[model samples]
Target: MRVTRRRPEWRVTAIARDTYALEQKSPYAQCVDYLLVGRDRAAVIDTGLASRGALRSVVTALTDRPVDVWLTHGHADHIGHAGEFGAAYLHEADRPVQAAHSDPAFLKRLLREEMGAALAAVARPVVRRVTAIPPADYRWFGDDQVFDLGGREVTVVPVPGHTPGSVCYLDQATGGLFTGDSCCDWGVLLHLEFCLPPAVYLESARRLLGLQRAGAFRFNWPGHHGFPAAADLPEQYAACAESIADGSGVVRPRRHHAVVRYRDVLITLPRTYLAQPVGRR
Candidate 1:
């Protein structure tokens, strides 16, 4: 169901007027990248794994316009194939995270801890292929930075929590917020060493909820696992982060980590972090 004879590597869906969803298929890794096409040029949200083949060709296949890559965050899965591109932008805060996650051995071991050892071993080849290092000299952009793709424009909303530089891109034309690895239906990962405090994520969640309520964007386009996230997903996560911040959230074990789950949404964090006061943390 993931593929057909015509397209083997990706499943393309026109999620918005000029926006397309390029999803990697075959094993269905669920890594989704968004391509926004404009009259003069194009903007790609993230480059997916190299195992799917050259991402530049994929974007060109959709639009022949000149393209610039914008990263939602610097995590390994989201920043895939950045080195192959001519121009890629990332937040300065996640510079360390980008360097650390670029190592294949480190990523392999971390994958083993996150996904079982057997699965990690199975995915080793793809992981190795995906360890394409992003450019060290990146054009850094902070919150409120806008990338103008001719008629289309994407504004960066700094929602740093999953990573210090994590962000969501808002497409002004379509009201589609491309949430790259921030809080999603699956989870928000603040348990990692490089992640910011849970309180930071809580504030971000509240802000995103406010934006949604204020009709800043109609829906959330998640980075992984699913396509369009539920309308209330941000609200649910805001509640979850609030509970975790106030020390009222429930914690349970998952494989090798602990998470505060709200229905299907998960916020992974450590006990030490959970114990700290919101302000101190």
Candidate 2:
């Protein structure tokens, strides 16, 4: 897999296809969006970021399928550009944020001051202005929500703690989970804002562990860079959460794009557990 970092967005390419993300440089990385392609129709997992036009271009280049967008949460960066799409979907709890995307100026101010200035300069000469996708375009996700994307399917799993309505999209056909910042390589560790207490995040992490143990997924595509495969990450996350819950886990601060090494820390409860079964506890 190749990760391409554009001016304010990141594009991940796999299997000769691509997924887009927006991460303007800031103390806190705002939001990360993804565009999942299919033969007939395309699904964009998140849309609020600096890459609204880029996201649209990538989707169009991949396929002419009617695009469907869903947000992991309703943060400004995750829902801002959603208005450009014909239809956008997000959790019911995030509808207000999505509705706010209709107002371009409001959305612009929400961006980091520097990013807003850059964005303004780009939009001045652009022929089209940002528009809003109608409310009818939204889809509310309940538990076990299923989206049929022709041959492949995306299951909406409520991954709270990060946000009241935050979710992860699991593509059964690919064994990949589109984790929207539920986990990431970024250095910012502000759990208080995006999620509940550390315990809530831990439970969410444990839930992902159960799915990994069940062989539900193999690849983990997080909203941010440096994601791990299910076979490599699930057990580790579980172990970390277990340790944290018991006051035995030590979270070593790592760099923004540091390469994670298993030996640096214990590989107790992640998807790696499935990879090396002979050493199982």
Candidate 3:
């Protein structure tokens, strides 16, 4: 069978009234950023990895209101174009990762490791563009910070597991919860050096579940390819993590490491980390 790939480009889709999903596809990664316009100012979530300042043009065409950049986490793919915008805001816990990624050397090292030599060679220009525009300054914010954009309010919910500072933005006006890589349809990655253990991640998932039960938000917009995840995704993710925490899930090898799969969610971790007694919820 022949394989086909989606051409990488910058496209915008209106997800809701006054809200748009700016999707950027590349050979390296597919990133879905968001733009929320309010009565006064507008907010951009998770600027996609676009070199040449294409994202700025997209946002400008969407709304002329003052814009603020808010990061879901410090991942390179998410914050690559953040420098084009003014000061960006992120959780303090992720500052280290964000700072490290801002360095050209560190990003190059990461590309070499994650993409390997052949792929990295092809992805070098994209990587350079990603790191070219480093944010002038990153404003640190904590959990539960409410950003009021005139009539719309977005509450920051800390969902630390994908990354120490990973968070979901709950839009009070639209009932949309923007979850970066914290939870997704493809799979939630928990194997990186900066990622938390499955047990700890379960807590964050449970918290989201609590919000879901309380009618806090209606839908989820994941960071990557999948958008508007099913409402029960948090519950399902929590259950998967629970099994992993208790050593009940079957382990399978993937890319030289073991992972526990639960439905659409995959929990990847080092064997030693999985054997640790901590974070057994």
Candidate 4:
């Protein structure tokens, strides 16, 4: 679908006491970026495929505190407006994708290949609008790194499945976990070149499950669709992974890729990974 200029602009919804979700309704992808406000500074998670000025304007209207942008992964939709923010951070594993996506030529190829040529033609303008800001210099952060936003602290947990550097941020004060596409209620996309195997993703799912069991996080906030995923989402994703490992899931073809359905989650991956030994990363 073509992105029209008449579509709704960036909108912000308060998700928690100090957390807000910025929903950008783009024809290419309806993405939700987040802002966690704190006493001293604020943290922004994921910059959607919106115009850099629009994202910056919405963020500035939300908080006056100093803001830091933390990317969930290196996807084009997630990092389009990243250059608008200062103190941006991303994982080293995603640097290659991030760097590649910053180029307009690479982005054009991605849109044509993944989203289809027809959609790519319509989305070219939107892509240009979002990419107006040059790629920002990103500092790297690893797993278990804690970002102290005054009284609130968000811990970064590495969950590399959707992409090599996919991560979830756990809010220590609110018991809310921001899972960026690693596990979403809608579905998980593991068919990309940078995506990890289902077995490797299963391990990460188990890690999130362990955190839930230990009361580290009470709720999950995914990067897309709605907020506060079902409590059993982690379990459901884990079961899906298990089914993929056991060769019990029914596979179906979509576009040019194959997807395996298990429980409420749909996993898209290469058939080669499914044929490999289970639990192999």
Judging by lDDT, tell me the better candidate of 1 and 3.
Answer: 3
> lDDT of each model, Cα atoms only?
0.79, 0.55, 0.82, 0.81
Look at candidate 3 and tell me the lDDT of residue 122. 51
Ten residues in sequence with the least summed lDDT for candidate 4: 272-281
Give residue 40's lDDT in candidate 4 (0 to 100): 97
lDDT of 4: 0.81
Write the candidate numbers in order of decreasing TM-score.
4, 3, 1, 2
lDDT for each residue of candidate 3 in 1-281, tens digit (9 for 90 to 100): 99998543777899999999988876665889999999999989998774664688889999999888989999888887787776788999998888777777787786776567767785568667765665645899987598988989899999999899999999988889999988788578887668886777989999999999999989899888667877788988898888887777776666534688888777777656545554443
TM-score computed on alpha carbons, candidate 1: 0.90
On lDDT, the leading prediction is 3
Model 3, backbone clash pairs (residues 3+ apart or across chains), number: 0
TM-score of each: 0.90, 0.64, 0.91, 0.91
TM-score winner between 2 and 3, please give it. 3
User: RMSD in Å for candidate 4, one decimal?
Assistant: 3.4
Q: Judged by lDDT relative to the true structure, which candidate is superior, 1 or 2?
A: 1
Candidate 4 wrong stretches, greater than 4 Å: 1-8, 271-281
Task: Name the better of 2 and 4 by lDDT.
Answer: 4
Evaluated at residue 173, the lDDT of candidate 4 is 84
